[model samples]
Target: MAAFRIGEAAQLLGVSADTVRRWVDGGRLPAARDEHGHRVITGTDLAAFARSLAESPSLAGSSARNRLRGIVTAIVKDRVMAQVDIQAGPYRVVSLMSREAVDEMDLRVGSLAVAVIKSTAVVVEKP
Candidate 1:
């Protein structure tokens, strides 16, 4: 249950903060308050919502990309830019990001990563 501020959630959800607020007010979403009493959503709730999206029969076209969460497992520096290997559950994705990001993050075998999938892109893929 990791809490996120409304603005952070809005950024993740790709919506306006006001829209998130309305969902909270309308009970279409849920939020909690900290000791300081600010509205917040938790990572647990977000994961649950992702699971719900997977379970809903109406969204049969959903893509498995939505289920990804990864960790930066390794980096291979080359004559060119470095390559990053992110382990997303049973899947390993090797991708190239800016060397700056790798340096700034100090990305190593244990560095955390969140593989983002914008909702509109959820779709069917060939089995």
Candidate 2:
């Protein structure tokens, strides 16, 4: 079985380290301590949590009708910012956001995610 540290889980879930800690502390996401007494989460559990987060309506909202679901093709992250590219059918949506946000959302190539657009604005809401 493969297990990831809390930081890794946070990266995979696209959430902050504190957020992941809160989830674990609150019991929203299940975790177990490793031999080093550090919190670790399994890949399966992380995937399931990601799915729930992706499906939650509050994150995407009901008014946003222009939602594109697709696979992430590329991601470029710097010290403070990150660029993510997603391919949704014939359309490609690119977004630039905080490096923390990108890390928290675990946005990476070959991962499934969604791009929400409203009017001229584009929001990258990935799972």
Per TM-score, the best of the predicted structures is: 2
> Candidate 2, TM-score vs. the true structure?
0.48
- Backbone clashes counted, model 2: 4
TM-score of each: 0.42, 0.48
The lDDT per prediction is 0.73, 0.84
Candidate 1 lDDT over 5-123, as tens digits, reads: 88887766655789889878898778989889999988888656545545856446655345456788888876557898888755787777777777887888788886545456446
Model 1 regions lying over 4 Å from their true place? 51-127
Candidate 2 lDDT over residue span 21-120, tens digit each: 9999999999998999999998899889887776756655476666678899999988999999998765788988899998898777999998977686
- Regions of candidate 2 where Cα sits further than 4 Å from its true position: 58-127
In model 1, what are the clashing residue pairs, if there are any? none
lDDT of 1 at 24: 80
Candidate 2 clashing pairs, residues 3+ apart or interchain: 14-104, 14-105, 14-106, 15-104
